[model samples]
Target: MKLDVELPNPQNLTEEFEWTFPVGTVNENGDAVITSTDKSPAKVKFKDVIGSQRVTLKTKLGGRTLQESVFNVQVAYNKEVKTVYFAAKGGNIMAVKVDKNKTPEMTIKPYDMGVKSGQHPFNIFFNDSSLYVLDCGRQFTYINDETTQNMGDGKISVISYDGKKVETMLTNVGGYAFYDPFYGYLNAAEKKLYFSDRVSGFAAISLDARNQTMSRSNFPYFVQSNRLGYYGKTMMYTSLNSAFEFVDGTWWWAKINSPTGVFRFTNADILSKEATAADPEPAAGVVFKNLVIKSFVVDVNAALVHVVENSSNALYSVPLDDTILKAIAKVDDIKTYKIADLPIKAEGTSAEPVSITQLILDKETGYVYFGLCSDDETLYKSGLYQYDPVTKTLTPIVEGMGVYGVAINNAKSKLF
Candidate 1:
């Protein structure tokens, strides 16, 4: 879009001009060619358009929008918005533009899913243009007794990337809750959704599209029955904090907190016989003990898991050997890096790290992303950031607000 206006007084050009876009379209920061003189027109890059549309331009006073003068123009699409979505404080889900090389980005409230935000969107994972959010809602104060049937509002929900559709999928969250499900992962290969609970290692949800009997409240799930068998028809306790896929029916779990470490198990052994966390010979679960990890993501091809320790300044790693990945009954692999040593840049000042809340990875690019919380505004600003494992580089993509979980959405069609 180009603009040219006549000005009787050169001083009139000192006032700010604001552009009002049409409805159903989104505008990001620009690639506009600006000039002080009125003789030449200014070119402004625009946003999402289906085919062609009309727009308007307006004037501003001290950051306030004045009366708008309507105008019509044919517009086209801006197709290259690689978006980053975050589960923020106060149940807000945020979307913003980003790039691969750690480019600084900006976002506004309008970028959210056009629907009411979740209560405490603890963590999120994106797939096929939909965001799977694990919210710890109800102020994190609501605790259901052991006899309860539902996990309530503080569970999983799905939201489309463009905010066109939403579904709350927490109807049959498997009985009681010693605590809420804090983090989760979607297993597309197995057609299941798994989440980590404080008391019961974790729980599962079936996303099998072929099942006609599946409903909102009667979904079949299994928690650890005893220490050995995991296919318990009802609820039992498992003390794993988080779970991630290793390969096929095999999985890796982090400790819930007592004796910290990771656990590995396969479905063949879990359902084949009874098992317990303390079993020595015929156990369904295997432990790689002693390291405390709250959340982690597995790199299937690399044979490694990127781990985040609770309240620590470092990021640790656990490697797997192909020969004994699922074959071994016990395991041990630990590597650490001081991830907090990298300062977060804000307003031209470098801020020190305060705390890390969540962690996720982009499988397509192999880039890691996480949410950081800041207590002091001047020292640091909370927002989304990315870490390049290959380059050992950290970049603050966007800052100024606290976020709980973050996910990457490559198909950001709303702004295209």
Candidate 2:
């Protein structure tokens, strides 16, 4: 005799299961009898079948098959994989799942931070669980025949990975007069956010303090008393356009304009008492002069700093050993420094020179990634490129989009 059976679709197999059978006639004793070949009509235990399983149920009477059915089961763990997040100019933050091949498997939807026109995401940094985004909000107009001023309303916001919550940590941070908040670094050890604000000078925000404030005092390298008597007398503050990196217990950064070169300051210097009008200047840290450093990345494990010179569109490497670092610290003024022979060139051609906007280093892989763009907006040459230090090869990864910022999630082994 034929019997009917039903099964679930792609059963989870993690929870309990129940099965119902059709009622049948009873014997003279007035008791219905039923039997299952594989424990049907009962709670199914999947302790032995975890990944994937094929189950079959059969009923037989007097060695004759009554009914048979088969079903498939899959067991999976409910968790989110690690992801890397990045953003481009006038674009929202996009996340990609970490993969072994170092290529994005898929692109997630744009993360909305509630920014309006004349405001966009400039940079992004990820901590253990949250993301820090710098939103540049400003409008520029010519003050007179020669000068222009920026009316500002910028902010720094922290967002959760799930895109469910957003918290504005700081607001009205200055950066629009020159460049936006182009680069930022998170010092987990010090619990501070160091970012490059061209207008207000390099600034830092204390993560541990209850009040969210950005101050130039946090950056001791810049001389706040230096005066510029052009148009009117104004204090000449340092303009930083690169991300800061911590190497060998010291913080290293580079400037975009005058006194342009790589510099470093000890943690003690950053944590020291703020400078006062009487003092005016903090203890000058080590300065490497005669180099126009637009952006740089430090590979602590390799003991080298890869630098990008904006003017020449060239790439150079500098040693980070104590011998060089000590020589710099001892000098009263900016000292001449030496750079190793060029390993890779960023210059494109005589007609159109490629401008390296940002640089990111992957210490684990010894690969340097850079974002390239040109002065002409009509040209579509702007894109992302990768340089393998070991092989000394520069290869284009993606094209069409002008990448302003790039970051890697080391813990997740993902690149953005």
Which numbered prediction scores highest in TM-score against the true structure?
A: 1
Number of backbone-clashing residue pairs for each candidate, in the order shown: 6, 0
- Give lDDT tens digits, candidate 2, residues 27-141: 3354543444333333333331122234455544444555556543333212233444555555545444432343242322222223221244545677766677765554321
lDDT of each: 0.53, 0.48
Model 2 segments beyond 4 Å from truth? Answer: 1-83, 97-122, 138-150, 173-182, 199-203, 206-242, 267-288, 321-357, 374-380, 413-416
Q: After superposition, which runs of candidate 1 have C-alpha atoms over 4 Å from their true positions?
A: 1-81, 101-110, 139-144, 147-151, 172-181, 208-217, 223-240, 271-288, 317-336, 341-357, 376-380, 410-416
TM-score of each: 0.65, 0.55
**Worst ten-residue run, lDDT, model 1?**
345-354
lDDT of 2 at 392: 62
Clashing pairs in 1: 201-238, 227-275, 227-276, 228-275, 228-276, 229-275
